[model samples]
Target: MDLYTFLYDLATGPLLWISFLTFIIGSLFRAGLYIMASRKMDKVTHEHFSLKYVFLGLVRWILPINRSVKKNPVFTILGYIFHICLIVVPIWYVGHISLWEDSRFGWTWTAIPDEWADYMTLTFLAIAVFFLLRRIFSKDIRLISTFSDYLLLVVTALPFLTGYFLSHGTLENVSFFGENMELIHMLCGELMLILIPFTKLSHFILFFFSRGATAVEFGRRGYSV
Candidate 1:
């Protein structure tokens, strides 16, 4: 009947089920395709670990995933910070932290607390937004930016902004718009989870594509080998 009740319903009922199913299906589909594609690509015996790097079955991902981006240390580190915070904060937030603690490897983390969560979320969201805007407004990035690239950022960013505002009760009160903001935020969040494994965001899950691609191209061209 009210905003909180509406959001509570979406968060608890249909959206949760749909989100879970979508995540499962989407993850499997993306991982399956990536495996098949990597296998199809010509192999190099010189490849380290003697594996197809299925889903970027590489060492960087095996580690901190920032190794491959060493060429640009600042950007890479910031990227890592942004990603870890983006993921860790939400999972550890008061809203989801208990479920995560119960269901996920007995894992526990210190959350930023509610108001601070809003602050951190807004700060990180701003950084991500700035990065996206930088890519958009710059001539070089604009040229290199694919439609999927921009689209991915759009999908990823909207939830962050909306959720941050919702959590803060700033731009959109928890009771506003029939609780549409919360539903919109949760649905977008679900969409992002379902979409992540398939998109370039998959890079986080599969950085080996870039490394393997780089290795093959360079070796074939007699460049960096």
Candidate 2:
């Protein structure tokens, strides 16, 4: 009914504990793996590990030509929109707004305009699925996309599906603070957040290394990889 109730009920479950542990452990594993792989990649390529590339990649996330995804702008745009939606809606949701209120942000569960937030969340959910379909159906993408790539698409889609179900109150019995769909959604999402720092999704984190790998691989021949 109110913020207190939401917070009180939100804390009342193994969901939080399991989600937190999964997140923390998954994150550490993801980070460790990425670091090890990156180091290995650098040594193999005889390329120096530089934060400059990382920072540039972060900045370039806002731009179009990634040098990595440049060969496929349509897919890149779809991927970008989907990911941007993922970032925007979840952290800005009404549930998260509770934390903002308890803090000094002068915000609360009521802060985010619901329909707009819902739209942002759903828009990306649809686009993300579209991207997955494109990968499956498109001749070029299908040829190059790996099993891991398809798995990644599916993994990313699940949170959005549950999220859409939650956002739209589409479940049989919708209760944001209850130990129901919201809890399941939260757990799955936390798993994603935790896995992010470790998986090929870490490619999102290591865009520079990814780009630079291509850049250098082709730069030697005077072309962008």
Candidate 3:
């Protein structure tokens, strides 16, 4: 096979599977490590843990009922929008749903309209740029930011950008590094999945545990987090 076909097959087949498996296994391993460390270093957190407090904490933060939300309403709203679009658009896009239906499992689900997916993708990209600017311009945030922080933002945004291009045929006639836009999109998505477990994106899995533990600790003292 030629290079393009080879790359396309690799991206859609083995590499894709490897990325998914790595994400799942790595996330579980990280979670296991966190549990072990927490149990060993902070016995009190578990000893006094309350499921009620954990649930409450998750609800408070998940909604806009927290102090942080109150203090930074704009940022909070943008964050929610970004996350929602980030999650919803990918899972609900017509193209993605079709792929699922065509897969060996033949899973199928209703998808959002193509127009809606387009709008959401644009919104996601806009918010990603906003976040990058915030990190660069906000003095306090900048002070705490590292190279990895900026890199993660770019990594997170690239798949969406490339996907948008692929969907709209934005660069269909152009080839970069001997690869088409679809290949780039696939690679970016796979790279993101691979990185999620190792990067701050792992918060997708760890957020509940960390937030719940904090809530329990504070709740035991008659406080809210």
Candidate 4:
């Protein structure tokens, strides 16, 4: 096969399946581990469990006036924007919905206009850069940052940057990476998928459990949390 066809096949075929399986299995395995570990802690803190407080605690975090959000308004706002764009662009962009329709199910949803998606993508990229710089220059964050932290930042940014270039035909205009630019962009996305459960990205999944524990503890104190 020629270059474009070969790259297309790789992106849409085997690599897609491999990456998806990795993401699914890895996520389940990590979640299982968290569940098992939480059991031991549950034994000790069983009295702390309160269904009412669990939901209340989660609601407290969702509110903008929560202590954490209040402590870092700028970070919280940018972080929420970044996450919104990150999720909306990929899932709702025309190109992506088409791909998902073809690959996963014969269903497609309305897509965000390309122009708006482009702006959102840029915003997410900018926020990602800010996060990386914060990790590097902020003393407290720097103290806790690890190599994986840096790697996560890079991996997270790669797809957004490459996708922007791909959409704008920047790579094609320069003949950058020959005809493989789209493939590279797709690979970066798949790499991110595969890393989600194994890396700090797992926090997305574990957030609920952590917040529930905190809520239980704090709710018992008779505060809004």
Candidate 5:
């Protein structure tokens, strides 16, 4: 088989399965570790755990009805937009929904229009650039940022970048690093999935646990986080 066909098969078949399994299992393992550490180091967190407070904390932060949001409205707005697009575009895009339909389970769902996906993808990319520039230029943020921080930003944005190129045929005639855009997009996506559970991106899952714990702790003190 040719190189592209070989890579295409690998990316779509075993690699995809491995990426998903790693993401799911790694996330669970990390979560378990967090729980164990919390129980051992801060038993009071469990003692004070309140499901009600946990839910409330998640809602408040999700809606972002917080002092930080109030203080930095522009940043909050952009953040909300970025996150919404980041999540919605990938799950609801027509191409992704088609992949789900083609999977073994034959799952199918409604997808957003192609136009909407394109717009959201562009918006997401713009916001990602904005965030990167902020980290570079913002004094306080720059002080706290590390190499991993910038690397993570690039890693997170790469799949979307390549997907945009693939979808729009932006570089269909041009080979990049000796590979077509589709291969790059698929590899980037698989890389992201594999990295998610091992890196800070695990916050996608762990955010709830951490937020809930904090809320429970604060609620015990008669305060809300």
Candidate 6:
């Protein structure tokens, strides 16, 4: 098979299923492990369990002017943009939502205009660049950043860059890889899905758990008062 045909088949068939399964199973495994670890760490009775603080913790994180914002307001805003686009663009883009409906759900809803999704993708790309630069130039961040940290940024940004290229036909005039950019974009996206559970991208899962745990601890303290 030619490069384009091979890429298309690999991206849409085996890689898609492999990535989705890996994401689902790995996320469940990680969440289960967190719950088990939490049980071991705190042996409180079920009667004392309250979700009040957990809800509150989520609110705290979602709202601005908290600890994360205080640490660095600019970075916090950028983070919010990155995360918001990460969620909004995928689930709400017309093409993507249509794909979901066709593939599994058989249901479709109104999507944000393609123009807005394009703008959001640009914003996400900008944030990724800023993050990479911060990790490089900031002494404290540089000290803590592992090689995987940089790799993570690259992997996360790859799909957006390639997708933009595909949409704009930015590389179509080129001979070697231009024709295959769409498949490359799909491959990058699938790879990102598979990597999420194994890498710091697991923050998507752990963020909730960590906040919940903190809230539970706070709840216990409140009960004593």
Tell me the whole-model lDDT of each prediction, alpha carbons only: 0.67, 0.66, 0.92, 0.85, 0.89, 0.85
TM per candidate comes to 0.70, 0.67, 0.96, 0.90, 0.95, 0.91
Candidate 2 vs candidate 5: which has greater lDDT?
5
Compared with the true structure, the alpha-carbon lDDT of candidate 5 equals 0.89
lDDT of 5 at 94: 91
Preferred candidate (lDDT higher): 1 or 2: 1
lDDT tens per residue, model 5, 36-93: 8989888998988789999988999889797779899999999999889989988899
Residues 64-157 of candidate 1 have per-residue lDDT tens digits of 6534566766667667667776876677687666656775356667766777667667777877887788788989889988999888888877
Model 2 segments more than 4 A misplaced: 1-14, 40-54, 67-70, 99-112, 173-179, 212-225
Candidate 6 local Cα displacement, residue 108, angstroms? 1.8
Ranking by TM-score: 3, 5, 6, 4, 1, 2
Runs in model 4 deviating more than 4 A are 1-7
lDDT of 2 by residue, 1-225 (tens): 976557446644454566567666765666567568867766644463345444554556557756547687777877777877777777777766764676554665444577877787778877877878888888988999989888877777677777777666687454553446665576567667656655677666466446655444444554433
Sequence-dependent TM-score of model 5? 0.95
Model 6 TM: 0.91
C-alpha-based local distance difference test score of model 1: 0.67
RMSD, each candidate, Å?
A: 4.9, 5.8, 1.5, 2.1, 1.5, 2.4
Q: lDDT at 143 for candidate 4?
A: 97
How would you encode candidate 6's per-residue C-alpha lDDT over 8-49 as one tens digit per residue? 998888989999999999998999998888788766723356
lDDT of 4 by residue, 94-211 (tens): 9888887886578889999999999999999999999999999999999999999999989988999999988887767566564677888999999999899988898877887778
